[model samples]
Target: MLIKYLGHAAFLIRNVEGIRIITDPYSPTQGIHYKPIDENADIVTVSHEHWDHNAVDLVGGNPVVIRKEGERSVRGITITGIPTFHDKEGGKERGENTVFVFDIDGLRLCHLGDLGHKLNKEQISLIGRVDICLIPVGGYFTIDVKEAKEVIESLNPKVVIPMHFKTSSLDFPIAGVEDFLKGTERVKRLGSSEYEIEKDKSPLEREVIVLKPAKSS
Candidate 1:
């Protein structure tokens, strides 16, 4: 699959069947937005109701938003939604969020949407095994660097991609990417805004991938 990190939580994923799935298209800043190469997609997934993380209108093409825990099939991808609390104890300002699992070919890809707090034992169990995890590391309304470490440990994903941290847009005053990697070691910082992953190769035993945000328009 081809995964492109479009800043914040937005990403464009092209699955095994040549279907594109975009996740959480939001404005770059509070008032400004970015341009997408392929604005249209076969499917779109939103984690919660946050204004930035749920900008469905900015995206082009026919997209469907997964509002709750359920399963949906678009083209050949098997998308499953697991309900999760937005905050540590489900008492955060935004209420709840949806963690989506994209099963394309043999890869199990998980995207954690606007996750405000750490996942509980029960929530982790429901996540199952994930090959690639797209997680948010911003502090104001999501898990910060320290808490993100705990969450990643419990999830035990083969590959972890950090997102939603500080960028050019400081609409939300949060920490930068450095905050997320302060205590971690040997993290791979890819300079590209997009990455391509195939199922043939062996997954990373333990790795944190830092990618550049897609150049906004």
Candidate 2:
């Protein structure tokens, strides 16, 4: 499968069967400043109703949008949306968030959409095994670096990809990816916006893969 970072919390994942899925399509009006998302996908997952993460209209291909918590199979991909919160206060501060788990091409990929708090035993049990994790490390609006580390330990995904952090184009008061990378080991800087993982072929271990945003500044 190929995973391409589309800036912010958005990602374009394509499985071996050529089925494409886009996660958390952001809006330009949110002051994110990432190049407008113009990619096409077979499925689009929205974490919440927030303007920055639920702009399903920006995506093409007349994709199927999944926003609520449930289990569904779309185009041979099994997607499970676990209800979460955008704030630690049980959605009182921000709103509801959904952590999407995609079973594609023999791999289980989890996208923590603007996750606010640490996962409890119940949430962890529901998520099950995770091969790849797309997490948000920025603080103010989501979990901070410290909490992110704790969450990573719980999920224990073989591959970790940090997103929704501070970037040159983002005006949010969030920390950069560097803050999350500090003191981390086995970090691979691909220097590109895309990374490919082969089933059983790629080294499936605890490694942090950093990729540049695909969208131009």
Candidate 3:
């Protein structure tokens, strides 16, 4: 499976069969200056109703959009939406968020969509085993660097991809990815936005992989 970062919290995940899935398609009008998401996908997952994360109309191809929490299969890909929050105060401050888990090409990929708080025992149990984790490390609106480290320890994914942080295009009051990578070991700066995961291959010793935004201005 191939995972391409489309800036912010959005990602385009494609399996070997060419089934494409997009997570948290952001809106350029919401002060996020990243290039518009004009790509096509078979499935689109919206984590919340926020303008920056739920611009379903921007995506082409008449894709099937998943917005709620549950288990479903589309085009032979199994996805489970685990209910979460956009704030630590149980959605009172911001709103509810859905963490989407995709089972594609014999790998379990988890996308934490604007996750706000640390994971409890039940949420971790529901998420099950994660191979690749797409997490948000920016502080103000989501979990900060400290909390992100704790969450990573909880999920224990083989590969960690940090997203939704400060970038040149984003104007949100969030910390840059550098804040999360400070003093971190086994960090691989790919310099590109795309990464391919082989099912039979062993996990990388370099756990944290940073990818440049694919849709920057």
Candidate 4:
């Protein structure tokens, strides 16, 4: 499977069967000076209704969109959405959030969409074991560095990828990825936007892979 970071919380996941899944397609109106996502995908998973994450119309093709919490299977990929919150007050502050877990091509990939509070034992148990974890480490609207660390430690996935942090294009006053990388050693800076992962050759232990964000166009 190939995972490409499409800036911010959005990602394009493709498999050998040509199945494409885009997560949290962002809007250019968010003040990010980049092109909008116009590619076609087989599926789009939206975590919340926020403008930055729920611009499903921007995606081309009549893709099947999974925005609510439930079990869905499409093109040999199994997805489970667990209910979460965008803030600590049980969705009173921000809104409802969905933590999506995907099982595709023998790999379990989890994406925490704008997750705010730490997951409890029940939520973690529902998520099950994770192989690739996509987490939001920026604190202003999501979990901070310390809280993100705690969450990563709890999930203990073989691969960790941080998202939703500040970048040159982003206008939010949130912590950058540097703050989360501090004191961390098991990290690989690919310097590129895309990564190909083989299920059979995946790591046995946890490691962080940092990739450059792909252009919005």
lDDT of 4 by residue, 1-217 (tens): 9999998899999998989999999988857755678689999999999988998999987899999998989888999999999998999999999999999889999999999999999999999999999999889899999999999989989999999988887888898999999998789999998989999989887889997788643
Models 1 onward score TM values of: 0.91, 0.98, 0.98, 0.97
RMSD of each: 2.0, 0.8, 0.9, 1.1
Enumerate residue pairs that collide in model 2: none
- List, residue by residue over 46-164, the lDDT tens digit for candidate 2: 99998999899999999999999999999999999999999999999999999999998899999999999999999999999999999999899999999999999999999999999
TM-score, candidate 1, is: 0.91
Whole-model Cα lDDT per candidate?
Answer: 0.79, 0.94, 0.94, 0.91
* TM-score between model 4 and native: 0.97
Off by over 4 Å in 3: 204-206
Better of 1 and 4 by TM-score: 4
Per-residue error (Å), model 4, residue 80: 0.3
- CA shift at 55, candidate 4, in angstroms? 0.6
lDDT of 1 at 115: 80
Cand. 4 Cα-lDDT? 0.91
215: Cα error in model 1, Å: 3.6
